[model samples]
Target: MTATAKPLPAGWTIRLHRVHNLTVLTLHDEHGTDREIGFCPLTPDGPQDLTVSALDTIAHPRLREAAQNVVTSFYDRTAAARHHRDAFDRAVPDCRVLLGHLRARLPGCRADLGTDPNELTVTLTLTATTRAAGPLHALLARWPGHTGHGGSLADGIDQDLDSSGALTAALRQDRATEFLIWYRGQC
Candidate 1:
């Protein structure tokens, strides 16, 4: 167990330790689940030797954003340009607008942004009961990743419920998903 914590995002803490000459960045959630984001080889220059890809693997969306600022600070001209371009290329255009519209369309529901553990992609998730499914399904019909090869919503959507008893229907793309609506039964 670690003694103290660092100034990270709310409810999250970061710890760094040396392992065989490498620095491993670990994150602890509110529940104290320790997740090893990734590790980088130590050098005389310290974290400046870290690459964009290596730093990008830091989990937790807020923590990732914080790490990106520090990681990109040491990048060279070419690396910095590539990092900027890749970031722009990975973003979903007008994402806030879409989320706002989603919230408006499904009143009383909640909408949130989700990122994969690897920080490679982003998703917009709408959490609602089956009562909102009809509207959500209609919206999904027009969006990409809505239908699988068979042209059925079920095909595209993950059929199984997650541990939280919610199923997600995602419109996946290269860097972002158009939408990832989570359906849960009413309480």
Candidate 2:
């Protein structure tokens, strides 16, 4: 028999030959087993075209190039948001330790933090800080992405910051205050 051909996708082969004035094709498996795939009449002046689809070659409908895009896009976005949320969950407790550090390190300081979680996003606020050092005043400085209020500790600032942002600010200020973290059960 002829030498085995190079590797091909399953159920595909380099099989084209003239037989009875027709161009015939075949398929081979790894074991060298093969069978006629199709036969087409040759062009009078040249070889006839043999169109192949994975539908036939692989025995399944070929997927579009973007076939998984919708599912994949949803999975990717959801997974990332879930991971960020889980990370935010884990980060909250760490803020307490940072609070302890800040209170111990900063001068004559008291702190009050508030958290609000509304379905999709968690909002944090530095409701209170007192007698904090001048240098540490900007520790809670709001950046571009955060919503902040301009007021002094006497005014009872209720500035809105992301949880992670507040955590960073709390760490820098070295103050921790108690939070009544019990979530009221769904009504």
Candidate 3:
């Protein structure tokens, strides 16, 4: 009688290979499953060729619209500009708290902040170009209106210095929700 060899155990493996600026990825699963993914640094196209497309596709118009609505609602619910501005002065630390909340809840979005007693600004940008905008958009759509005017959606993306003359003490607030929505829609 002849004896046969035993097969390998169940597991997963990833292999990478490159050729002429192109990268090839191979994944093998212990259950005898295998798949390949590929990427190229160069393309045959026009001026847009300089841009790199996301490997994954995303479809989340509803989520994006929800985020926009949230921003607008936050602005409308707040009182006069001066009152909102004062609230911003009182919520500089709260802005940081909100940022942490966003990062934890929205895996693909990131927030950059600058604030002083007089101004506060937070810019949330998309970090994952390939994933669906749902999670990030949902997070932003729920941003609490109490974050203050400095933390409001109307703020722009500019760093401000505080009253102490130290860049650290500047109270400047700017929100970049539109920027995030624009990025989410980019192909």
Candidate 4:
């Protein structure tokens, strides 16, 4: 059976090009130019073919690290891409739990968690907003969870949770003292 070629990693439109009869890795260019990045020489296998694993161990460490960085940077981008899901697999439940606890304290509280994308970048934000005030807003405004007021909602209180430490502090927050010491854990 013939070996089927696997597609290159995301953000990598690269292929093996023939440079002096040697297989060199090249990146795609909009002007149809081959930008040579690294070399992936082949073993003495008749027609001179190289495996994907073999190409990774090329002589150029910079090229290998560069390709790896391209792949690694995409790690977070794909986490929320499947089925249009939001948040990392583990963070989903934590977000839900925090939202639920806030809802219990303030029935009018609501949450929105998802990705914000532009022409070049994407970001994740998990926010909870509530119309209640006086004491409830003060409690959520603690560290880890950023609480704010005076938006379009007038009497609305906005809270955002971004780190696991903030999540843990939010979970343990039970009072609205004048100066409560919130532990953001090691997040």
Cα deviation at 30, candidate 1, in Å, is: 14
Give the least accurate 10-residue stretch of model 1, judged by summed lDDT.
178-187
TM-score of each: 0.43, 0.25, 0.25, 0.28
Model 4 Cα lDDT, one tens digit per residue, 1-187: 1133233443445444444545555554444354225554542222233223333554455445443443333443454354344223333335455545555655544433433342111222223333444334455444433432543311222233334323212221122111122321211
Per-candidate Cα lDDT values, in order, are 0.46, 0.36, 0.36, 0.37
lDDT of 1 by residue, 63-177 (tens): 3444443323223333544554455345545556656776777664456655443333444455655556556556556665556677755432443335554444542333133
Q: Please report how far candidate 2 places residue 125 from its true position, in Å.
A: 3.2
Residue 135 alpha-carbon offset, candidate 3, angstroms: 1.1
Candidate 3 lDDT (Cα, 0 to 1):
0.36
Local accuracy of candidate 2 as per-residue lDDT tens digits, 1-187: 1122223355544344445556544544445555224444532333343323232232212111121222233345555556645655565656555545556665555444433222222333333333443423454442221222553432222343344333223311111212212111100
Per-prediction CA RMSD (Å):
12.1, 20.3, 22.9, 13.7
- The better-scoring model by lDDT among 2 and 4 is 4
lDDT of 4 at 62: 45
Predicted candidate 3, C-alpha RMSD: 22.9
| Per-residue accuracy of model 3 over 95-184 as CA lDDT, tens digit each | 455556555665654455333322323323334222425554444345442144766443333332334422211112434433333333
